[model samples]
Target: MITAQTFKRGSRPRPFLMGILNVTPDSFSDGGKWDSPKTALAHALDLIEQGADIIDIGGESTRPGATPVSREEELSRLLPVLKELIPSIDVPVSVDTMKADVAEACVALGASIINDVSGLGDPDMAMTAADCGVPLVLMSSYGDPSTFRTQTIPGDGVLYAREKLAGLTEKALEAGVREEMIILDPGIGFGTSPGQATEMLAHSSDFSLGRYPVLIGPSRKRFLSHAFPGKDPDAATAEACEIAASSGADILRVHDVGRAAERF
Candidate 1:
């Protein structure tokens, strides 16, 4: 399981695995497959068994152009699964939502981490994470939520990601979140142009905000879709994971736990 000690600088050379569990019907990948509480719980256990250090569960689809679900709707889809899965799993579970209310509710249900892909899209998200005292994953995504996938980096992707995360980290600190409990993600492939995303991912180590652990989610993203297209799904994902790890990513957010466990 991931704790504050797990994220200490120089503690991890190879990135730890954080499996993705999206309980939404519109996620670009594997959507509608595990939206049910029972199936989600089963998949969570399977992931843990397959060597997942953490499980990140999201109720709403953060895929580009997907409408944001209401706070209540998100909780409705996420809470029941968390209620059944938290007590059953040994590894940590992170609630992936930009809404502060959803994060709070999940934390109350014993969630160990908060992964806000919006990088504090909800004004109170930082405060909620601080109040819950859980590790917060602030992924650097630019522009409006509606344009997350199509948003273009104004300049260098690495610089943009780093600067954005740095500002968000400051906000989190001022909101009472300890610096050690903070984690950073470069939001690889969330924006436009495969080349831009590739550059951001290649220099992932440079986006380390607050000197915190960097978590890269390059698993099966569109940017990597063009690489080795006809190969097995995990083939490209494994390569991306290797790149992220080699570039100093501390956590790998991915879908295929079995393949990552085997390779990493």
Candidate 2:
């Protein structure tokens, strides 16, 4: 089993359950539910009790047509909650961001992992990750949220994700980020069509699991909305977790930690 030492945080791995904590008010799902620090921290504690191995906090909404939040606003929403929860939560905290400054600040505030949806597209991201001595969870996506919704690409999503991740891996290596500190994510629903997302779900083995542990973040994604019409997004998320676990994904980034834990 891959452990934190296998990646950036020097963390030990045991079927990591990454709980999603979206601080934005416009996230595709459960956006406004936990916008406050008190509510967010309570939810985080509940996730830990329900078996979340990691807490992934995000301030910006990356959903389709989502507007970007300013760096100051993003940090304002994130740092207070992080400062309050970092000492209270037992699991490692992963700050979900693409901005170098935001990531550096979060790491400085005790975040153990950097979950970059851009796959370190920012030139300074890798350097900051290396400097912070934290593990980086790099997700493979072709474009930002707005562009992702409009773009289309061919081939299996897993294959494309693998190719993109391979390039990013090389870049991170060149930037002095240790290979063991990097984790690969297929970026479900980020830039893929529903068909491609399903293909990746069915064939996640195409990713380079030997080189880096695979992280599958399919919780309440738009692809799931299309795949399981008339089903609850939470149930669909649980289903995705089962599929991911069986498909060799080492970690599952999800919103419903309790349900996913039961499935696991």
Candidate 3:
């Protein structure tokens, strides 16, 4: 199970596995397949059996150009799964949301981590983390989460991501979230073109996470298509995960926990 201490710089294991579970109907990958609470809970349990160290559940889709769901809609899809999934799973449960109300509700019901892909787009999100004292995953992206589509690309992907992440980290710090309790995500494919995403992945260690652990969510991102054209997404994702682990990423957020656990 994951705890605030589980991600402390010196105490972290090498590339712990975080399995993805999207309960939305529009996520780029595996959407609509587990939108129901029963199916979602079943998948979460299977992830644990597959050697997942943490299970990440997201209600809204963050795919590029995807439409955003209302807060009420997100909670309706999310809360039910949490209510049934948390008590049934043994591994730490991480709620993937950018809204404060959703995070609060999940925490109250036993979520141990908050993986907000919006990088605190919601004003009250920072305090939600501070007040709950749960580990926060601050992901860097330019546009809205549902549509992380970007018309402009940064010249230096590393510098751009570092600056974005640094700013978000500052916000989290000011909100009273401990540095050790924070985790950094490069937000691969979240507002980046294929090249930009690749550049950042190649130099993940240079993000200089220090006390804050770095998590790389390369799973089945579309960018993988460029890296390995003929390769299946899972195969491409596995290769990318290997590169990320060798590059010093502390956590690997993946779709296939069984394959990842076996490789790592």
Backbone Cα, N, C clashes tallied per candidate: 0, 7, 0
lDDT against the true structure, per candidate, is: 0.83, 0.83, 0.84
Clashing pairs in 3: none
Poorest stretch of ten by lDDT in candidate 3: 145-154
| Tens-digit lDDT string for candidate 3 (1-264) | 355558533544457789999999888889999888899999988888998888999998877777877889999999899999988988889999888999999999999999999888998998889999889998887666544565535577778888889999999899988876788898888778888887778887766555567888998988899987999999899888888877778788999988777776
Tens-digit per-residue lDDT, 156-264, candidate 2: 6677888888889888889988877888888888889988887777665566555687888888887888877887988988887878777767788989899888885
Q: After superposition, how far is residue 176 of candidate 3 from its true place, in Å?
A: 1.3
Residue pairs in clash, model 1: none
* TM-score to true structure, per model: 0.94, 0.93, 0.94
Q: After superposing candidate 3, which stretches have Cα over 4 Å from the reference?
A: 1-5, 8-13, 145-147, 150-152
TM-score of 1: 0.94
Top candidate by lDDT: 3
Query: Which regions in candidate 2 have their CA more than 4 angstroms from the true location?
Result: 1-14
Answer with 1 or 3, whichever has the higher lDDT. Answer: 3
